[model samples]
Target chain A: MIETSHLSFTIGDSQILRDVSLSILPGVVTGLIGPNGAGKSTLLHCLAGLTEPSSGHVRIDGQDPFTARDDDRARMVAFLQQSPTTVSRLRVEELVAFGRWPHHRGRPGPEDAEQVAKALDAFDLEELAGRPIETLSGGQKQRAFVAMTYAQDTPWILLDEPLNALDPRHARNLMARLATLANEEGRSIAVVLHDINAAARWADQIVAMKDGQVLAHGASRDVLTSDTLYACFDTPFDTVPHAGRKLVVAT
Target chain B: MRPWVGIGLVLIVMILASLAVGAASISDGDGGWLIWVSRFPRTAAALLAGAGLALAGVVIQNVVQNRLVEPTLTGTPEAAMLGLLGVTLIAPGLAVAGKMLIAAGCALLGMVGFLALARRISPRDPMLLPIVGLIYGGILGAIATYVAWQTDLMQFLGIWQLGEFSAVMQGRYEWLWAVAALAFGLYLIADRITILGLGETQARSLGLGYEQTRAIGLVIVSVLTAIVLVTVGAFPFVGLVAPNLASRWQGDNLRANLPIIALGGAMLVLGADIIGRLIVYPYEIPAATLVAILGAGVFLWLLHAAPRRA
Candidate 1:
């Protein structure tokens, strides 16, 4: 379980996240949705222990993420920032294998290798395992990063705007993969997304925020209603049933 | 066999040629004695300086995560020269080891200042960091020039500015052996250095102490540059060319490629020195000038050739 209580983050003179309080259950995808500059990314960073909140608490699985050792924190949560990259020509397998570092430190045993192979297979990256990551297309690169995160074997996975450059087909495939990871492997995922429909189709729950505060928090069906989205985005939105789920549209 | 083995054999051949191709006459009867005293040390100095500067370049490039920037471009050599100038004026009687220690300290300071400026730069523009470093280095070089002129140590400054191996002797060039130890130490932690090229957030996410690793890399670069400067003046482009060429062949699995980069550097500098000796015969050119011209060509080629992200 991931929980934040009265979490507030202030940078210099501006307050980025204010008095945010929420709990995320394991084994489900939680979509963090808001308009631009709505503190969604900042809240995700605080939850991942990458940034400290000014005057509140963040706890993952009953432990303080900020105070835990790096080894312990990495084991508990795997956080992938937006489009993280390296200059060196690391092959896909090598990059994914580094996810096992916190576990084996440096020396790799059979189980670690097994997990790496499995991650590559899971992401369908076996064909590209030997290729340099820089040579891959953007969607392929994003999939490689996701494969790396999955190889971490952490209970909680946090991602920030991972679908930005991906086309719709790649986006759907990636989201479906995350949902499978949540449902089958029992990983808790929190993804910051700009597209409301992607979140509506794949996310089990939604955390809506506006101007640095949570506007609504519930199941996707309840939190993604037309009224709630308008309140969150300050724009009119219409919800219509499509393919057994609602598609959010601008009006 | 690995490609570097072939490169290594060629390097050995070049070392032999450098041993045979000095200004000494073939009729000089004591060739063996000259080998023990002059030729051996001079050849060794070229190889060691080349390896050290090249290794220093790899370290800084990884630390800053930019291939275009290296120790010489990043105010390191100029900063070491400034420290040497300071010691020459204040304590002219100091030992070479003592001068090297002070020079290392000043080089570290200069690198720190350049890193601070680099932080404000957006990494999207790969050209910016090295350009900033060039300007930073130029400013420090100007300061060193002014100091040397004021103290009438311009002659010493000139020698340090343009490196050559004509004066290396057994006793004079032993200081560069520290680089071998430094390179060995770097190899032991090559994995950590490789992680540095991943930028801050990813490195930290992988449970690396990012700042600490960068600190260690910068210190090694400074010490390595200072040692080379104190021993054989300065060599340009040794750092930039060798590692890059090595990478183009073998990927950046740094642990596996560290030796290749070092050897490539060793061969390049030794070859340059030999060419310098033969260019004008008994009236030899400085290896630094030759490398500067060659390195500038490679630099331009790197900038415009295919425009891959460095």
Candidate 2:
């Protein structure tokens, strides 16, 4: 379990995250949704140990992520940021091999190779395995990076806006992959999403934020309510039942 | 791939020619001994320094995540040059190895200062970082130039600044082997360096120690540059051009580019050294100055070929 208690962060004088306490359960997909400047990314960074919180502590499997050694923390958690920048000329296979760095440091044995191959196969990147990342299209690159995180094989995966440049089909495909990972493999996935409908469709739990505070967080059914959506987004969003599933639409 | 292979072949040919065709002439066994014992050290120094500089360029580009960044462009070499100046003034009678160690130390310190200043001013704006480094280099270079002018040692320092392998003999060039060793060590850590280029957070997520790896990389680069400066004088752009060329064809994988970068750097220096010898026949121009000109031309071509965002 990953937990944050009374987390507050500031950049200069402006408070980016304020008095936020959250618990992310394992074996579930948690969706963090917020409008622009809502500190959704900031909170994700805090959770991933990319950002140090000014007030509170974030613990991943009971160890402070910020202070934890990279090898120790990497075994428990993996983070993928928005538009994950990479060295352009690295081949897909070599890029995937980077996931094993924490496990073996730099020396890759036969087992590491097996895991790398498995990651490529899992993400359907086997065909493009030797291709340089710079040559791949936007969607392909995103898939490759996600595959890298998957290869990390951590219990918890945190992704910040992984679907930004993806088309609808690719986006849906990525979400399905994450959902499958969570349900079948018993891994925890926390994703920061700008699209509300995807969150409503795929998220097991949703945390709604507004102005750096958690406005609502619960099971999908509770957090995807019309009142909560409206309050968090400051706009009217109608939550309608479509085939026994929640559909949140802004009007 | 063929072009790179061809370049490699051509470089080997040039290296042989460099060894064969010096002012001493090949017919005389005495001249042959001069070539083997005296000039060969310079030749090896050229190969080592060239390859080392290019490799350094590649690492710097990756570390800063900018295509245009190089030792010369980013003022790293100038900082190294200033270090050389400080060491020369403070301890005029110091051994070459001692001078190199001092230069490396100062260059590492300068690099740290640059990083600190960069962090303080702006984290993401790399354009500012190089500009700041350049300004720093200019100030340092100016001080060095003024010092050289004031002291009767101006001519001696000027000779060092304009890189020449004319005086490199066997005993004088053993220190370069240490640089070659440093380059190999860098190759071992190249994967981590490339991973760090993705960003600190990404590196941390991958279980790589970002600060530690970066510090080690900068230190290695400084030491490599310092060794070259002390050994072969200050040849600019072998680092920048070699890495740039390697990236064009070698896929920017540090491991993949290791040998390629080394060979490319060797080729550039050897080829330049050969050409410098052939031109003006008996009166030899400094190999470093000529290569810098060639490197500048290639650098411009590379600038044009680089991505717009880079």
Candidate 3:
């Protein structure tokens, strides 16, 4: 389990995350949703140990991510930042192979190669493996980056807006892959999403935020109410049932 | 593979031509000693300096995330020159190794300073970076020029300004071998350096020590630039041209491309030295002047090609 206790992050006099405490369970997909400037990304960065909280702490399986060595922390949790940037001339397969760097630390064993092949196959990127990332389209590049994150093979995968620049079809495919990884493989996933409908449809648990504070946190159906959505986004949201899943639409 | 073989053949031809085509005839009496003392050292210096500068260029480009900025553009060589000027004035009797260390330290600081300034600028217009770097280098160069003038070291400054292999003798150019060792060190960490091109956040997420790795890269760049500067003066654009050309041909996989880049650099410098020897026919133009002329053309072509590539 990854848990944060009374975590607060500040830059100079500006507070980005204030008194936020959250627990992300294993074997589930937790979607963090909020309006712009709602501190969702900051909280995600804090949880991923990319940033340290000004007060309190974050723990992954009872160990503080901040105090852990980089390789050790990487083994425990893999983070994909929003708008992930890569070297232009790097090939898709090579980029994904970098995900295994924490495990091999530059010396790739057969197992590392196997995991890279698996990641490429998982993301349907085998065809593009030899292509340089700069030559790929937006959706393909996004898939390549996600495949890289998957190849990290950590117990906890934290993605900050992995769907950026992706079309609806590609976004849905990515979400389905993440959901399968969570449900079948028992890996924990915490994704910060701008699209409310994606979170409503794919998330097993939902954490809603507004003004640097948690507005709601519970099972998807419980926390994704019209009232909580409206409060978090400062806009009216209507939740309707579709095929036994919640479909959220802004009104 | 065929292309590599072709390049190797070309390099061999150039090396042989460079060794045999200097002012003194290698086939004449006492010519073997002349070849050993002058021709061979000059050839080796060209190759080593070219390889080192090109390697340094690739590392600096990755570190700063800009292909246009090389050691020459980033004020690295000028900073080293400034350090050398200080050492020459403060302690004229200082050993070459001591002078090199100080220059390398100064080059590192200068490169770091350039990067710090680069961070504040948006990378939208890529050409702006090199222009800014050129101006920054100009300012530094001006300062060095002022210091050299005040100290009556104008002739020394002039020699450094235009890199020439003409003066390279057996003992004078051996320091460049340190760059060869450092280039081997660079090869070992080639992957880490490539990861650094991914920017800090991605590098950090991949369990790479971003700051430490970047510092190591800068140090390598500094040492490489210092060695070249102290030994055979500054060769502009070899670093810039070789890596850019190699990346264009082979992509940015440093592990696979570094050797090619090194070889390409050596070839370009060796070629320039040969052309410099033959162009004026006994009144050789400096290798730096010819490289500048060739490099400027390629650099402009790169600028024109960049938009399409992007």
Pairing residues by index, what is the TM-score of model 1?
0.96
Model 1 lDDT tens row, B1-310: 7765787688889988988998885348998888889999999999999999999999999998899888888999999999999999999999999999999999999999999999999988889889999999999999999999998999999999888888899899998999999999999878888878877776776777778889999999999999999888988888998888787777788888899899988888888899999989988888888888888898888788523567
TM-score of each: 0.96, 0.94, 0.97
Best by TM-score: 3
Tens digits of per-residue lDDT, candidate 3, B1-310, equal 7997898788888888988997778889988898889989999999999999999999988887778778999999999989999999999899999999999999988888888889987776677777888988899999999999998998888887889898899999999999789989999999899889877777887788889999999999999999998888898898889998998888888989999999888889889999999988887999999999999999989888864322
Task: In candidate 3, list every pair of residues with a backbone clash.
Answer: none
Note the DockQ of each predicted structure. 0.70, 0.67, 0.62
TM-score of chain B of each: 0.97, 0.91, 0.98
* Candidate 1 overall lDDT versus native: 0.89
State which candidate, 1 or 2, has the greater DockQ: 1
Q: For residues A49-84, what per-residue lDDT tens digits would candidate 1 score against the true structure?
A: 878899899999999988988778888888888887
Candidate 2 residue-wise lDDT, B7-43, digit = tens:
7677777767878877777778687677779767877
Q: Which ten residues in a row are the worst by lDDT in model 3 chain B?
A: B301-310
What lDDT does each candidate get? Answer: 0.89, 0.82, 0.89
Candidate 2's DockQ is 0.67
